[model samples]
Target: MFGLIGHSTSFEEARAKARSLGFDEFADGDLDMWCSAPPQLVEHVEVTSRTGKVIKGAYIDSVFVPEMLRRFKTAKRKVLKAMELVQRSGIDITALGGFTSIIFEDLNLLREERISAVQLDWQRFTTGNTHTAWVICQQVERNAPKLGIDLARAKVAVVGASGDIGSAVCRWLQRTGVGELLLVARRPQPLVALQESLGEGRILPLEEALPEADVVVWVASLPQSLTIDTDSLKRPCLMIDGGYPKNLDTKAAAAGIHVLKGGIVEFWQDIGWQMMELAEMAVPERQMFACFAEAMLLDFEDIHTNFSWGRNNINLAAMDLIGEASLRHGFKSLGLEPASSSSPALSIA
Candidate 1:
């Protein structure tokens, strides 16, 4: 079984949980955690490729913003508690999901005396961002044509190109073929290093690159809203909103830009019953975000290694491997709706 740590973006989303916990009220940074045994699987789901792959798990919600995670004490407490909960629930591997992975990126609880005393293997914990990048690339490729932008000859701009997701997207775009890639981020050195390492893209500030881009992907970190002169983008540009809080300005969509949020994938089968309940959301049956799917796929493959970790670690080979596995397991890039052909979403397999 695989486990995941998640978080809510608003206090309203967790208000009931807080009340159930006997609290009079809930604040923005409040945390919640729970475990699910042998997750709910639909009957027909057994006929799919993921057939015998049973996933039971636990999740934690550490409300939004990095300010709450600035102190090491908070991260350590939440990380350790979440780990203990998953371990005690009989989960074999626990994947850090959402901001939980970002806030606790380099934290090693196994090295701490408290966890060392328990003798749990830290290797069982993996960051789900690897497969996320893979799916993002697939989504881009699948949707590019529908958006009327040909990636092979389009000027692509990646916001937050220095971040884990943005960097990986850049690497994949470089390999997949693009007319030009504009790397954008606040940090210059890492952007320069990444540009030099990739040896393909040109490093430019977000402002300078925005007007020249035909395809814009927003993956910047929190508090840094993606501020671009959308009117200056090449005519009929493709904009992908791939950030956690959704960086794209929705107004741009009304102005005729094609925008698709990151982490969304189309599943060929109905395995969403239990997964939806676990997430506590009313997601559509066939659609799932790739980050959550990563843990489920890893559990199905029975590969317990720390597959993806650290910043800027996602590469072409790993992305391809995971992409292939996801395809084999009934996950496709067929967009959110079957009428996706008429929509901005791409129908990829």
Candidate 2:
């Protein structure tokens, strides 16, 4: 009964990651309502770890702020219903998917007839997911030659450079030797700070940055008031949008920029028996959401779930740890799809 709170690709992918890490079986029709319950919930509640127990007994799902709060409310009710059904069917463990884990902060308030309230905090889950996205993207770049993408000389623009995801990407690009990295954001100070921290490169506002970028990652965590129009972006760059309402406006994407929905790919180790049907199915990195990577990474060490990364703060070391864990878990990036270097890179000309 994991509630996929938002409609964006990242949220759904995160939801899938939750399924991979927490849920055991994935039947043909997930909505069928006839699949057998997980063995842990039915007969082996305490055979393993406390953290897994905490997550298993919880029904995780995604939920954003004011924009989709209503959706969260609705999803909350549906989950409550699912818990009730599960209780009647002799199952006690609740379903907590990755997105649901985001909203876990408010579990104390969630009250059902026979079950404990759900817990979540979107801010934490989102930041964790975004951090994982940054780590995952970099790892993908490390193996980009296999994917026919290059990062050594990539002209990249990070839309939310001032924030956690954007800044992390900037640092990652620099570390990986991206030839020209352009960071864009509303406030230049944070971007400049990141630039200063990196001890090199350019950090400019969005309007001045995108024209010549080879790969542009728009992972801005924006408010409802913000929407990126075509006039604000340049042409033909690979646009990776990780925003909720979507940072790449539909028309702006028409400017010939190939837009990709950033996502995560999680590997399930302990649940191999449950996934025997798809034994060889290693979830492509694109299949999981960034937050799920964050959770899975944290889950591995049995650490408490928290907002470990975001725009408010920059923790490069923590980001590195998450990146290392993903590589160990068999996840890789989609690589940088290069545009012709001969074309003018920036609009300043």
Candidate 3:
């Protein structure tokens, strides 16, 4: 019995992937994978994505303050409550996704029960091919010849440049020939480092600098409740929300600011269920997720889990590698949404 725990709403896609990995999809339309039980062939465990169902567990880490510790304790209590329900219903292998894995990422919760823990890398696999910034830079350059969007004429502003992802984006902007680059972040250290690495430029914090930018890229993991006054964002501007959980409030963002969202090209073949097994077995070892490839490969010969690469700082190289790998593997981008008739959307968000 494999219990995949995640928000069913947001991770319907991941659930599908889990099914591809041998989980079965029952008549209820929930994921049911073949479970490795003691001396038994297999069993069925339902994956519930419903809310208010208690999820019992902990993500305790060695390093944290008292306040953080209290928060973890509360979260663990909630998780344990949910897991208790699943146990009563009969689930042997419990896997956590999204935020659940964040808590378990640090602590070993499986030791407390008969449940097995799992954390699917999802999108953030780090491959060595290209960095996300480099990949975005390449897209800018690649599209420069074809893009009605001119990079040379654009006044660039990279928000949160004091951080890793922001710094990479800034470097690419600098080299890609922005007419002017406005650096926005917290303190002045990274801004100074960027300037030193790429020569003199104007740098300011995000609040003071956003109004003048023609192109603004947000890449930091800001806390919740942080809000951007849409009016401060420039008109006729292109805003790229590159941060996970999204930095700019999509709802509150200025209308017509030309938003550029980011995501990898996912190929979901409705080749139906017929060819799934073959595809799984035949997927090349090198075709693993970019983020966990090296680590995951350490344990197995067929390291195809990370068919797409990932990184915290958004490695453009990993992005490129995933793209290149998918193409080489003859994986066509699935037609999704309005794209249900066209190709999958692949490129920087």
Candidate 4:
């Protein structure tokens, strides 16, 4: 069986979800109560692939909210505890989703495996980044043509290009032979290293890259003070928002610009799980974050190991491996209908 470790987007949402799930104590209590709350295995899931292979899984809510980020120790404890619970459950493989994965990677939780005498088996968990990168890249490849943007002749900019998912997307785009690739990130050192590795990308500031991009792949969180000027973007620009809290549509709303939700995939058959509803997926029954699907894929193929982990470890070959499995299992990139005279700016597929 596979497992998914996840969390709510905010404190209020977390409280409301807890209440709905009959966790009245968690709902009635304050943020402090949440910090002390243990992870809960709230749902059981069964998915059948196109090849008729059925896999069973469970969803373990970390009971973590974004507010816990202010308390570093609390945040670390929440993630570690959830991981420990999954390991103790004897799950064949598991995926860390949302902030659970972020906290795991950011805090380097690998070294904190010994939690109260229980050792975390790293092989049983996956960060799920490989499938995410693959889904985002597939969105770019499949949707750009519908808008009349040929990737080989277009200038593409990847915000947060030095991150695990960002770097993997860059490698795939580079291999596909984009006309011009602009690599943007906060740190110069990593950005420089990425550019040197690619041997063919332009490392530029976000301000300079935005206006010139025909396609923008965002995998980083924008600063609270930052505001995008949608008017300055290219006439037929395509922006793929691959980050958390996916609010780019509100930030960059304008005519002739399309913002596609990235890192999302749609399954042909309903998986019959409520976890996606809590995640606010458009089609709760059929759609999910690509990261979660990675665990399902791993379980289906019997490739039980940490498929994706650590920083800068995602490569083109790994992306291809997962991408092929995704298609074979009847998973495809979430579709988007481009805007036209009669259609709205963007419509989900």
The 10-residue segment with the lowest total lDDT in model 3:
32-41
Which is better, 1 or 2, measured by lDDT? Answer: 1
103 Cα displacement, candidate 4 (Å) = 0.9
Best candidate according to lDDT: 4
Off by over 4 Å in 3: 1-148, 222-224, 247-252, 268-323, 326-349
Model 2 clashing-pair count: 27
Question: How do the residues 1-349 of candidate 2 rate in per-residue lDDT, one tens digit apiece?
Answer: 1111222233344235436655434322232221122212211211122223323222222222232344555445444444343444432222233333334323422333344443333222223654455654654364333334466866777777766556667766777787788877877677778778878768766666766666677776545454456554444456666654444545344655556445434333233222212112223212345554455445544454443532346465666776676565544443233212221231111
**Model 3 error, position 101 (Å):** 9.7
Candidate 1, residue 113: CA error in Å?
A: 6.7
Per-prediction tally of clashes: 0, 27, 40, 0
- Candidate 1 scores a C-alpha RMSD against the true structure in Å of 5.4
Model 1 lDDT per residue over 1-349, tens place: 6666665454454445445444443422334322211121111222235454555544444333244456566666656666655555566666776666766566745455344345556666777777878877776787777667788898889888988888999989988898899998988999889888889788887678877888877787535543456667667776677776654554354455666666666565555344344344324455555776777677778877677777788877888888888987777653323423323432111
lDDT (Cα, tens digit) per residue for candidate 4, span 282-323:
777788899999999999999999999999899898999999
Ranking the candidates on TM-score from highest down gives 4, 1, 2, 3
Tell me the deviation in Å of residue 50 in model 1: 5.1
* Candidate 2, residue 5: lDDT: 22
Candidate 3, backbone clash total: 40
Top candidate by TM-score: 4
Once model 4 is optimally superposed onto the true structure by TM-score, how far is the C-alpha of residue 215 displaced, in angstroms?
A: 0.2
Tell me the TM-score of model 2: 0.53
lDDT of 3 at 73: 58
For model 3 the TM-score comes to 0.48
TM-score of each: 0.80, 0.53, 0.48, 0.96
